[model samples]
Target: MSASSTPAPQAEGQRRTRRRTLALCALPVVLLLVVALFAPLPYSLAQPGETANVLGRRDGKPVIAVEGAQAQGRDKGRLMSVTIAATQPEATVRLPDVVRSWFREDRAVMPREAVYPGGGDTKDAEKRISEEMKDSQHKAVTAALRQLHRSPKDIHVKLRLGDVGGPSAGLFFALGIVDKLDGDGAGGGLTGGRTVAGTGTIDADGKVGAVGGVPLKTQAARRDGATFFLLPKSQCGEASAELPSGLRLVPVGSLQGALDALKGIRTHGKVPSC
Candidate 1:
């Protein structure tokens, strides 16, 4: 072959090799972008939500006020409810967002099935949460009245938890009711001028049941300046592992146990710890 023709062929071959190498390198990047934009992840992200004061008012109404009983005492400390911010099943979560959430300390990456069971829609999830909240309120009122040895007919307990939905606030709801009805009396009110945050599902029998998102709840509590956190005995380990510094975790199996712990806090008595 002639030298000029040979040089042209060699140059063309080098160009083809470079093009192939470039295409191979670009393939992974293109695939990653496509997956990050189009592919939906089966997981959801949960973050810490704000803490609400159960003893305070929401939208101009007392959250836990009684009509018959005299609700006295200044705002000594807060009775807060911890909440978790989560994604709905119907929402699209890309891979990049999931990866980012996984690395964020304040965010928790969990299976979508774990957050929304049965693959239900947002409306279905809201309905379930509303029902759970109503059930929790009823159980909380009953438990508080029973603990106070008061008849439901004698006392009218009105809970004004506006727009907040979940059974996790049950424990705090009961405590708020008791605090309002008891009016800072000895053995009646237990807040003791200290901020208290808690989460659990309560029953009319005063049994405390475990709830999800304890770690996120704890973070919320800590951010809200809570000194103590009350939770179910079953969730102690998980909560303890993620509990922030300067916050104490107290485990209770029953409403009475919770009251006792609060009483101990007030009187500087020995309190149960997780």
Candidate 2:
């Protein structure tokens, strides 16, 4: 080939070579970002029925039972019941606004960042979505507070936990802690005024889960004097058989449903005002 032709071919080859080089350099970075954005966080790892209280005993007996309740039809969920025998029997808990608000947004669980810089024409959308997730979680927690605050006379609580990503239980967990601090005494609303305790998640719409760790939670509630335990309907049959004496299992669907179910309860000769 002529010298001129040689130069032209060489130029074309160089251009193609540069393009390939640039693409090669960019590939690893894209892969790295994919991994970084999609990789799970250490703390994000979770297991089903892992966080429940599974001590397996009630009142020094090898058998401890908790109940779960659920109603058939739309807009209804579930409730939880527990029995336990413990030293600090008298306690009541209330739900706080912040905690309830977290569930209102429908994102009960948050895993690690999955895809960063995704669906964004610019980089700002990623950050915005992250912030929005945080805000929604906060609001869900707030909604919970509104429900628990409605009944300040009853405290010792029962709750049920569910599958992974079911952090809605966190809100109920907070309320349970509060009950431990404030027993039935007056202004806080958490009545039943006895040493009763339980566990279940609080949603904006007030749905409970048929959770695991029943044996443990039931023992905890009975130990605390929870004469009546709220449970989801689905679990009552299986859970009730394991309950000890002095504990009755009540099934409920939503939080409102549980409240309605409580209408018949006479805590201490006087009906509770919840």
Candidate 3:
């Protein structure tokens, strides 16, 4: 009986020692978790941002004009351009925020290099966005003129959207110009009398290019009352991740595809899906 009682205490002590050792082993892991939660990460957060209808007014003026071209839309429908609020090139996003962004429907996390080109400072990033904006405007106009089969010299295109810098608005800008000049080439408006929103980089040849931060842009589109969204074909998968309800996704490969999608939505015709 004495020997059995002595071993019972020894077993209890052994069990206590095992628990202490396990806790000691777990301490470093807990510390790492805390560090990870607060450590600065090389990523950027994309959040829902403002939307502007290219066919509508801003500051009591037209956002797009073909120079003496009779403005269309506003009452018929709205062609909205979606923008996303994101961390600048020089932002230090923490790991916790990045993880949180992934779970939030209105937010997204992107690699710093994916959104902003590397090997440049914040100023360089701004300059690049500015140049891209100007280039997108030119390409949008050129694509519009090409679609209309008109000479560039015959048309003077002027686009005003405040200090917004980004190339994602190109597709909407082209649509606005086309709507102002001609109505879907079928006596119908480009917007099909419905609020449409989209994002993509435009080429002079009418090819649409993928723009990042599409998931957050989709949230902005839905928030802005868009019934249809035109996004580049390449980023359809990304856009589908957090797409808000009541917004149909239209995958466009070019300027003409987007116009057809809007027209299809109006006429219930066959439209391409993402």
**Top-scoring candidate (lDDT):** 1
Clashes of each: 0, 71, 0
lDDT of 1 by residue, 152-253 (tens): 998898887777788888988888887887745753446778898999989998999998889999999999899999999999999987778989999999
Model 1: per-residue Cα lDDT at residue 236: 93
User: Distance (Å) between predicted and true CA of 244, model 3?
Assistant: 1.8
lDDT of candidate 2 over 24-123, digit per residue (tens): 9999999987766555432111111223331122244312121221211111111223322211111111223224424442112222232222333223
> Each candidate's lDDT (Cα)?
0.85, 0.40, 0.85
Report each candidate's C-alpha RMSD, comma-separated, in the order given. Answer: 4.4, 17.8, 3.1
Q: lDDT-based ranking, best first? A: 1, 3, 2
Off by over 4 Å in 1: 1-38, 72-75
Residue 192 lDDT, candidate 1, scale 0-100: 79
- The TM-score that candidate 3 achieves is 0.85
Per-model TM-score on C-alpha atoms: 0.84, 0.36, 0.85
Query: What are the per-residue Cα lDDT tens digits for candidate 3 across 1-274?
Result: 3554345888989999999999999999999999998888888888888999888778888898677455443338898998888788777789878878878777778788888875377899889889889999999999988998978877798898986778999998998888988876656687668888999989999999998778888888898799888999988788877678898899999999888888788788988877
Show the lowest summed lDDT stretch of 10 residues, model 2: 69-78
